[model samples]
Target: MIPAGFEYHRPADLASAVGLLQEHGEEARVVAGGHSLIPMMKLRMAELGHLVDLQAIGELKGIEIADGTAILGAMTTQHELIEHADLATAIPLLREAALQIADPQVRYLGTVGGNVANGDPGNDMPGLMQCLGARFELYGPAGTRQVAARDFYESAYFTARADDEILTKVTIPVPAAGTGYAYAKQKRKIGDYATAAAAVLVGTASASVAMTNLSDTPVWSEEAGMALANGDIEGCVAAMLAAIDPQEDMRGPIAFKKHVAAVILRRAIDSALSRRA
Candidate 1:
């Protein structure tokens, strides 16, 4: 199927992009890397009168790290996440996870913002951001507001972003020195979405755990994380098992998914534990 015909826009600034959305209303959709939206449009799952392209906006593309913080522009590609030496050093979990998100071609064109903003549970970034305790910055006619990554998703393919707002960047507080991080994803093959994936970060006295494709939204169990911090591995896994609600699909039965989620969470926790100094 072909996407319904729509006018294309290239906005060089955030204000211009916002203005386009205000002018066109809900019929306008923003395009970043086009890896996700284009497919939806072709399937006619999404139809719009205006397609606002953010690629021309310099403010929406870049990576900056300083003063114990990292800022990634919405248009930054997955490949950029994997390639930036500074970012790789500051947040190695990002690079590790980005490497597993589809193959090279998709990663080259997939933007971090699109992956997270679209509220796709299968994408790797949302869960990882939750584990990292990152925040997303939104821009619109009213100006900018920030939402914690852990609180962003409302359900599958849905998020806190409003119709008139654009996600401009992601802000992450740099993890304390020597914090351990691991991203573990299991799939049938390369480029396939994770059947169950876990992101874990262990600090000296704290921990964070989040899972992808285990529920309608990313699962970040503060219960699981607290249990891990206290060194009760079983308790942590148990809490996460209780928190997730995976449905039966091509991946496997519900029982099998729960088992896989348990295994993956443990593996991620162990990997992170070993890396923690």
Candidate 2:
């Protein structure tokens, strides 16, 4: 289906981009890889007066690792994540998870910013970002503000980012030496969204666990991570099971999703622990 006609804006920098959004208000929407929003627009679910494309903004594209932190530009593609040698070394879990998102063709076009900013439950990056304790940087007319990934999502298809703001980067603290990480996902096919997915990180004295597609929002279980840090796998699993609220879908019944989440999370925990030094 053809989308309703809309004016297109290609801003060369972040400030101009923000200005366009401010001028257009809810009638304007920024697009990165055009994966999510474009489809909605085509279906007329999103009727926009202006479509602000971020592809021209150099300020929103790059990968930088410095001072025990990794800064990923919002426009960075999944293929870029998989291909960067230094990024892969600094955050192996990122590459591991990126590989699981859609297929190669989609990865080449899908942007990390789009994946996390949209608050889609099925997207893989949000849960992984929560497990990594990443921070999202938003640029707006009010200037810049940072939001914790775990605090960003309010519900499915909803996030803390105001319509006037554009997500510009993701900042992640580099895991300490010997921190082990794993992303376990279960899906019917290569391009299918996860029926259930788990991201786990086990450090010398810290642990983090988060799940995807089992709830309206990504489930980041602090209790479950604490249980793992204390070496109680069953406790971790039980806590995670208690946290997720999966609804019945074409995937399966609620009970089946819970069971799959449990099994997948356990596999992730075991895999992460084994990789630890």
By summed lDDT, the worst window of 10 consecutive residues in model 1 runs over 31-40
Report clash pairs, candidate 1: none
TM-score for all predictions?
0.98, 0.98
Tens-place lDDT digits, model 1, residues 1-277 = 8999999999889999999999999899999999889989999999999999999999889999999999999999999999999999999899999999999999998998999999998889999999999999999999999999999999998899998999999999889889999999899999899999999998989999999999999999999999999999899999999999999999999999999999998999889999998
Judged by lDDT against the true structure, how good is candidate 2?
Answer: 0.95
Candidate 2 runs further than 4 Å off: none
Where does candidate 2 have its weakest 10-residue lDDT segment?
Answer: 18-27
Candidates in order: C-alpha RMSD to true structure: 0.9, 0.8
Give the per-residue lDDT digits (tens) of candidate 2, residues 62-126. Answer: 99999999999999999999999999999999999999999999999999999999999999999
Indicate the TM-score of model 2: 0.98
